[model samples]
Target: MTFEREFFYDEVRDGFYIPGIIKRFWAYELTILSEIDRICKKYNIPYYADGGTLLGAVRDGQFIAWDDDIDIMMLRKDYNRFAQIAQKELPEELSFNSLEVNQDCEELAASVGKQVVGFAAELLRKYHEYPYAGSVDIFIVDELEKDPEVEEHRSLLLRRILFLIEAIEKHGKSKAVLKEINEIEKIMKIQFDQRTALKPQLRRVMDKIFQEFNGREGDQLAIMQFYAFLGNCKYPRSALDKSKWTPFCGMQLPIPEDYDAVLRAEYGDYHKKVKGGGGHGYPCLKKYENKLKTLMKGTWDPDYHFSEEDLVRPKIQNFRDIAISMAEAFKLSHKQLFEDCLKGDISTCISRLSRMQEEAIAFGTAIEQKKGEGTESVRVLEEYCDALYQAYNALSDLTALKEDGIEKQKQTEEICRSTDISSGLQKELEKIANTLLYYPEKLQTALKKDFKRQVVFLPHSMKYFESIRPIVDAVLKAEDMECKIIPIPYFDKYGDGSPKEMHYEGDAFPKEYKITDYRTYDFASELPDCIVINSSYDEFNQVWSVAPSFYSKEMKKYTNKLIYIPWFVTDEINPHAKEDEKAFINMEYYVTVPGLFHSDLTIVQSEEMKKAYLAKIEEFAGKDVAKKMEKKIAGAGSCLLGEKEGEGIQNVVDCFRLFLEK
Candidate 1:
């Protein structure tokens, strides 16, 4: 179970260095792969390296530098036999996670059509100092219709069904959700209970559909777990009917005899190197190391141990500490204020005093609950509060004197210098006030509950309008929702600040949906509940940049929520694969743009893409910001898919509602 192989940094490819940590991760995964190979061989079962793992073996003769996991596929029959015995056959150090062996893995099991039997080293912590434990993803390849059109039809049907199953699990069996499920069942000529564990029943139906073409002649093969758009999942039966052994990470591994065909089908130009980590991110093993450590220690909790209300007392103490600092500063300024007006320009002092007054008012409102308690701290705070009010009046009087004339200005300056206000007092008071105002309880209570929520869609160009259209349509369908489609202007950047050309596509919106002119829309005054913008790149876009006014940071001031949805879609990439990483890096300009970094939430096309966006964001913006952005990035399947297939629209709508509810 222990990996004896010592790892070190080495240049596996030109200019691509595999660090010791990643090398160790690869060794850990290879151990699991070797164990799987042993079990398959003992049981006389057949499996072949799939996806990025296969690509790496054939193209690189080892694990891809950026790839962090191993993937292997088995035909449906072999997969079933292996699943039946893998748990008992695996060594004590290794454990298999699947629906049959562990119900906790049911979601993952259902997502991948049948089961994704993840083999992990249970004694990893006991054996290794590094907390990370890598796994081998076991996928089941199912048979599909031979004809391309029929195969597409079957794939689409299964995709829609899977989407509904996910929706049912996420949103519960809402009436609309159930209706969509029923429509799919009717098409398949099947029936299931409308209530009482619909998810499991839908999963059973999917299983039935997956095996429909099994045991039939002239059937094509496909991995049904991934999105159909991935393009590389489908293959000819002959692709895997024959097998050959290949060197992978210094170990001989099983690969399809027609690996060229399989790799080509999955990744065109398989020999090319691209650098990007998998959905789990670069060095994906460490992504969940902490969570696993907690679980292993039996310290993980499924619920919050403390609530926001519980933080109120601690926040009050924090505010008091800040108040104490401000009060000490006031003690020094108090004598000077009585003797003279202030030391600086009357206008600047007036501005600071005004801000101090606002902070005092806000702090007073925040501490209203403690007013009747008659605490000693409260009594002292009241005294300083009064003094702060008087300071504001004194500054106002100096402003009035300055407006009088030059002689008045000289007198004001003398008065100010004699007063000598403590410059830091204003900052301290503002800090204290903000701490109180942003208390979890205060923020929770301040949430707006409007009768009708307004969401404004700002699409910069007609070409990418479809990206936000599904969300717009979903919002309009809601009884309590209203929206405006405001197509903003953009310019072709010409290296200089000046634009090469200005383009406005407001008129390009479909006649059915009214388009509001950006000039006419009062963003600051209207205060839309949510502002959805499709454009992410601002000034960084080389070819085109949206008008600065529509940038996420600026629009945030005018809306309660700012949502950024990508204007483009991409095929699924192996997050751990170096080749995929390279592709993602090429897209860094668009993926890590300001809109994504600044927005309250970003809706990506799929979970795989979300990982890419997050990894790149972390790489560019740093881990702290990426961690915060994690909750903000959601993978609601792309609307472009629905547009192309004329389905999955409801699924996309349901995903939007799910994220918006949060």
Candidate 2:
């Protein structure tokens, strides 16, 4: 199967590419989620999707293409209970790995839930390290504890210092996951005078904070390990109390009730534009070499418990290189950035973070378009992953620094006052967030028939263009919205027509269209912002509906909604057949069967027309298609604004408006 640009888009590929790898992983993910849903529903265990999993559920109602992990959050109590019951309840192939079992862990798992990331990690784990690798990543959310009016500023400072100390200590302890990374940070010869002594104090602060705020439900909640500053993240308490079921990877999953506020707090604007789709910042999929065998057996992990010796360092180091390399470009150092954040130098800290953000995006785009997961591609992926990790950490630490800005100045003669990247950084994140809204999915079904512009595909024979012009004109005239009519003349059948016979209705589809070697396949890119094909009404195929020769699959690449209008109302227009060639030919049967299966919305001339099409579908396709076709197919006589002509193109135009008004 050829690679698809997207993980899941159901249609006739213009160039015949099938996304087998992503599709297989998609199947595996759905199975695990479905099982989890079964258990959760049985117990009424409340969990809202967290991280990229939540992003996927909301953004496109599916997993972001490169995202491999399924992250979900639970209140501490619910998480504890689910973990206990899940061990035996989950099948052998599925494991519930948490901090207790896998000790070399830094995943403030609230408790590590599941790591539904696909092939690479699982297969590599057979030859490698890291313990918290399940199908789901679980994090804990605790209601904030209120006691002694917790000094948010002091606690915030303590948290940053503690995190920095821990990070610095771990710096040289673990081998740089990449060869280049091992050498890159040599310049950041970071040193801390009180590191050893400070760690003991850091523990005390952490313990004291958690002890004091352990049980109280003050106002906000804590999502990570830092319990001292109970209210720093300040997620609304109401976000977790209730949830609504949202579609995710083709399954309905629970999401926080107050998702808007939650997403804004976490991602600024969660729906910005970005390349390669979004999720927890890594596409953990492996090429589907064994996809068929796995799919047939229906298992995500054939060997859930594999080896534990090899290193994913080479894998993870590349990202470290990308982050620090990009940081150096802006003359900023990650070590310095973190150190500045510790001393409350918010200005320099954010400046470095801003650069990190840029590197992360550009680096991520390069990874997404990589031709294969070769050594270089893996390095890019690791860099992309690490950059995101570092960037998010920077943002989190920045929040902490701002919280403690007032006191840090008095303690140490450092820059004072809270600071924020309210300008370019905010804009940068917003732009990237909006870019993520348009990821690919299984199918682009138009749940409703709607269009901003109608690109009417004319027949190879230019004569039909003038005849249908009035109907197109009437439809444009009827709608209140702006309309651009593009009359694209193409060979309407299996093989016929020269592109040279073009008649332009507007500048959109020029009269003397240049690309004269026109084939239906060539029009995919030039399609308007929105369009639809009438299943039976198109000028495709022979005049009669019996022969499928006059077919137009030109609209297959259209990501927008496809609308259907009844083809030449033969019975109504000319009932007397076989006697007059004009009567019979013009009134020939319109075969809608070609377009019936693809309809997002189907419009008909009358209620009887809807029934006739439904019955025909039932006879050919089956009762299932007929039943669904019945609901999607509609007949309104006409929804046009102008006076109705019982037998003109006006009726078809009116049908076009039915979906829009709907």
Candidate 3:
């Protein structure tokens, strides 16, 4: 069977992106910008190239070649003056794309200005179907007052204007492309006739429509600032204090001097060489050596647009914004607790509070099972429960108790309260403080021992889930072990329908997001005796928890196995054990086979990868089991796909096919 495939760009009638168009369009954008700057300087208009365009220029002395738009800002007063000058001075081919009268044309224009002319030229030349346009964006920057209330009012108005323009652009008002062009021509004609020397004041007024639209209530200014900082700069890790004074786009934009230190804390080495590419013709710029290329695909192009339908789009919400949203959502949900009035409802709240408290106690029990505090996050959770209980009880009793009321109210209060309002809730809070507490530890213990006996190799995404039947059949056939190979739903992230099913796909992922050294390992405990993890430079310690001390301690505690597998490491250079490293720790006994070929019973994915891995094992283990196992490996080393020695060998596909063939 043959598969019919096509590149992503092929699907679009006139894909806005076509590789080289970025650079060419950027050059034209820059040239137009230079002209703007020249005119601004002559008239003393305070302006600065801002946002993504500014970021690209300052960071690398070039445009963010992947980005498809350019942004520049002018003081609101200067912007008003420049609007007048733009109409009279700009060449016929070049003009300001107002966010008003010609919103559609302006949207099209902004989209074009962001594209590199050369890249667009190449696409037009090659495919002869790509659309072309020319444009630039002018952001009017008003001096925001220090007061949040005033800033909020102004921001609401600005956002409303933006929404109207976007709506007009996305859903064209005209019926046809020709009709839209004619509309633009009429607008320009009206503007030209109104002015004697052609000042853009009329067009500028047309851009700002003060219509009667209810203003949205939210911290719009803060939201705008957050995105501006996140999308435009390499933010400092901690407080972002340094970002306040640093230069942006050749202007003294705000940034703190200690910004470099904060950046290093989060993205270590801030200047590492990084390899980049993801399907497209050119390599995208990367700040770190192993920055995920997968997440970066198609985000910078003009044509590849994804919708942001939610009122608060997660795709764009910054860390602070997320926190605020979460807090609000939680508050709103909590209001349901107070919406009803009854002694019974209060009891329900008491039960919930009790459960949370019980969970906290259980956490303590689990900590005792482990050698030490497993993770700091667990400890913080324990503290959160304690605080929550204190708050809940105080509130519950103050409202529930009614000493001044008659006998009936007094009896109801005593059931949930102690002698006083505070003590009653406090006693209840103490009783049920330890529910799902050490569950993770129990899971860890089970994983190390009982779970290791049965293991299955799972892809990031599962295609043929039923394919696991043969493997189960083989295991049962070999060891009299009646088992199952669970088929997990795989999300085919790379175009295909490959599922990304992993045993720990849901709850097991770290609750809090952080860049740390602890790595998470997956593979259901009951499925296998041990798991082989793939690693990268600094990511291994953080992403998979493969440190020698952690591995050995875990191995000793549960008698269940937590094996270390190294990829990209060779046996010859530091084979067996390096003198400086711990004996049990350095590369031996961890049982790693290269991803490609394993001379041992291990199956490698490719001949080339196998050859490289085998050479290293031979150099280190010398004439040991690694060598003996190499010869025993049957049917080309490529068959294993890096499965352990003595285990069954089957192609990823063959594993599924065997059940059918049977």
Local distance difference test, per candidate?
Answer: 0.62, 0.45, 0.35
Tens digits of per-residue lDDT, candidate 3, 1-662, equal 11111121101011111232233334345556656766676786665445545554445543443354566654345566776676556544455655432423433112112222222444333322222344567654322244556645644544443444444457644355335334444644532332231123322433332211113422111113222223222222232222343332333333224535433433355454222222232222111112322334643222111111201111222222232333343344334333321223455555555654575566445544432455443454466566557746654664554567567456755655444434544444433232323433433443233212333332211222222333434554543222323222211111111122222232232333121222333322222332222221111111122223223222223222222222222222222323212211222222332221221133333443344345444544444534554643323322222364433335533432332222
Question: How many angstroms is residue 632 displaced in model 3 relative to the true structure, after the best TM-score fit?
Answer: 30
Rank candidates, lDDT, best first.
1, 2, 3
Q: Is candidate 2 or candidate 3 better by lDDT?
A: 2
**Top candidate when judged by TM-score against the true structure:** 1
Question: What CA root-mean-square deviation does each model show from the true structure?
Answer: 23.4, 37.7, 30.9
Order of all candidates by TM-score, from best down to worst?
1, 2, 3
Candidate 3 stretches greater than 4 Å from native:
1-18, 99-131, 153-662
Q: Give a tens-digit lDDT track for model 1, residues 1-662.
A: 44432342222244343434455456657767777888889999999998889988887787775565688888889888888888777766567765555433533331111121121333433323233444678877888766778777877887887788778778887887978977987897888765467766665666667677788766467776553535667778898998999987778889999888878777778787755434335555444544554655754321112122311211112233334344444434333332222235546544554655565455445455523344444443454456556656655553564445878877756654564355443333333333323222322222121224677889977778987787888887786667789999987533122455688888888898988889998775566667788776666543356788777657777765678877666655554665566455444546656677667777776777788777776776677766777888887767867744444556667766765565
Report the Cα lDDT for candidate 2. 0.45
After superposition, candidate 1 runs with Cα above 4 Å error: 1-19, 99-122, 125-134, 188-201, 227-229, 276-283, 292-662
Give the C-alpha miss distance for residue 120 in model 3, angstroms. 15
Question: For model 3, how big is the CA root-mean-square deviation?
Answer: 30.9
True lDDT of residue 599, candidate 1: 72
